[model samples]
Target: MTEGSLPRLELWCELQCPDCRTALDDVRALRERYGDALPIVLRHFPLEKHKHAYAAAEAAEEAFVQGRGWPFVEAVLARVTELERRGPELLVEVAGELGLDAEEVELALIDGRHTLAVDADQAEGKAIGVSGTPTYVVAGQRLDGGKSQQGLRERIVALLEG
Candidate 1:
């Protein structure tokens, strides 16, 4: 099948949101079930409430540029509390642990090169009516998984199949 024929899931997420971390379970399941057939794209939507969220999003962009997008995302999401505590230091630490250049990660954060991309994602997310983290967009439908992910996977499956 051509890439355009595949179903895509855009996950509007905030790196510092614990709810986004929980939603990762659904992302993992989708990956395991559909693999390359499903395109699970991560969209940055840093909420104003989280002081470190914007920075984290930029750091994740750097990680993506360094070629470890999802892994870096998972690692940062796994430690939302520490991200809150340590701020940008936590980002550099995680990058180093993931074998990315820690100094380069720091420079990326400092230079703010990924700012526009992250900002664009946030703007597109808002344009799509995504007001919270953990929102899923699939098959032209918006699924709010911010509070509850109940039946979301099934809904996406139905859309993909139908």
Candidate 2:
């Protein structure tokens, strides 16, 4: 790898965390600014505190299979306030809004089809000091700047310039 290149950048986040929701906007801004030059990988770290988070994570993976991972993520995060009240059903509604198969999403949520993947991601996050939402990892550096878009952009640029 060359010095002037962005190392792997991953956003360890949960769908139900308010901090993660705010960070999501920052991530989207960075993605838009860099395009493929900075692909933000989303890792599920559904804090056990948020009851609806795990199911939302599973729905995200299902959406990924249907080629709508980030959109699904954005939609759910957009409804960041309604997460606890509606639980997994909120994901179904978000899917419907995106013209995705709402029933399929609901069924996947019911069966917990993507539970293992979500769990694995959580475990991986924990292994790397990611016990919170909005943890961004860049080139082996773990950053928990939350909603600090400037900090994230600097880190990403530094990695790419390394």
Candidate 3:
């Protein structure tokens, strides 16, 4: 997509890391502050080292097919710590909590139905030069660091002002 068609802010993140969750929180705060003026796209870049990373990405995409992409993303980030301690089952539980059909989620996970979607996300992220979790692209500028809510808001405001 052209820069004009791109979101004011786009987030390339992985759900398997606690740091990503924190960064996502900052993104959420920026969304609240800027509303539609700031658009954020969540892209999955599952780290190969994280045992359940790819599986989690697949799960989120499955939820997307069910029209619950954002909720699934929020649930995963909210339960990042629990997911590390517990397991993938907790992700399914979160999906259930978010009103997704548990059976469909289970089937999707078992069959790897959304594997391609996750793979596509990974490929796109790599093409965009995302080398790690929580990479933020704001108005065509890449910020490769963890950002706080206020910090993100400031950056977004600056972009808009410019």
Candidate 4:
């Protein structure tokens, strides 16, 4: 469970979310800025309003199985427009571009293979009063904000220094 010298930050976010999409750079930058000292754990928290969120969550899990979770997420975030228009099908297209099996992502999405994990994340978040996307949990502190790179960096620095 020991990640490294720094702390683990759990990102409770949904794919195709504008807030989450806006934060993509910040999350990427945080990784580059901290390396292994700070690791981000992506947690599914698909809001009910977005119909594609759950399927996207499953696709992300499938991507993780293929060792391409980060790329898959980035791809989805990059095309929020397509996701809003096409729903789960967007995952297939993105996976294909990444050389991951498009059918595999589709099958996972259809059969609900990763629903349990996604559901568990939702339950955990709900229990902790997570009412929105892009919630960040660091050092047992829940920061429900836009999770901007600057904000995230400030929190991490404060945690590391304190």
Better model by lDDT: candidate 2 vs candidate 3: 2
Residues 37-92, candidate 3, lDDT per residue (tens digit)?
Answer: 66677788899878777878888887888899877887888888787776679878
Cα error of candidate 2 at position 49, Å: 0.8
Candidate 1, residue 26: how far the Cα is off, in Å? 0.6
Q: Which pairs clash in the backbone of model 1?
A: none
- Cand. 2 TM to true fold: 0.91
lDDT order of candidates, top first: 1, 4, 2, 3
Scored by Cα lDDT, where does model 3 land?
0.77
Worst 10 residues of 4 by lDDT: 144-153
TM-score of 3: 0.83
Clashes of 1: 0
Best lDDT among the predictions, by candidate number? 1
Q: TM-score of model 1 relative to the true fold?
A: 0.95
Please say which candidate is ahead in TM-score: 1 or 3: 1
Q: Write the per-residue lDDT of candidate 2 for residues 1-162, one digit (tens) a residue.
A: 555445667988889888777777667777787778775788999988899889999999999988899999988888878988998878999998898888999999888789899989998998988878888888788888565545676766676567
User: What ranges in model 1 sit over 4 Å off?
Assistant: 1-4
Q: Rate the local accuracy (lDDT) of all candidates.
A: 0.91, 0.83, 0.77, 0.85
Worst 10 contiguous positions by lDDT, candidate 1 = 1-10
Ranking by TM-score: 1, 4, 2, 3
lDDT of 3 at 121: 80
List, in order, the clash count of every candidate structure.
0, 0, 0, 0
Please give the lDDT score at residue 101 for candidate 1.
85
Segments of candidate 2 deviating more than 4 angstroms: 2-5, 147-150
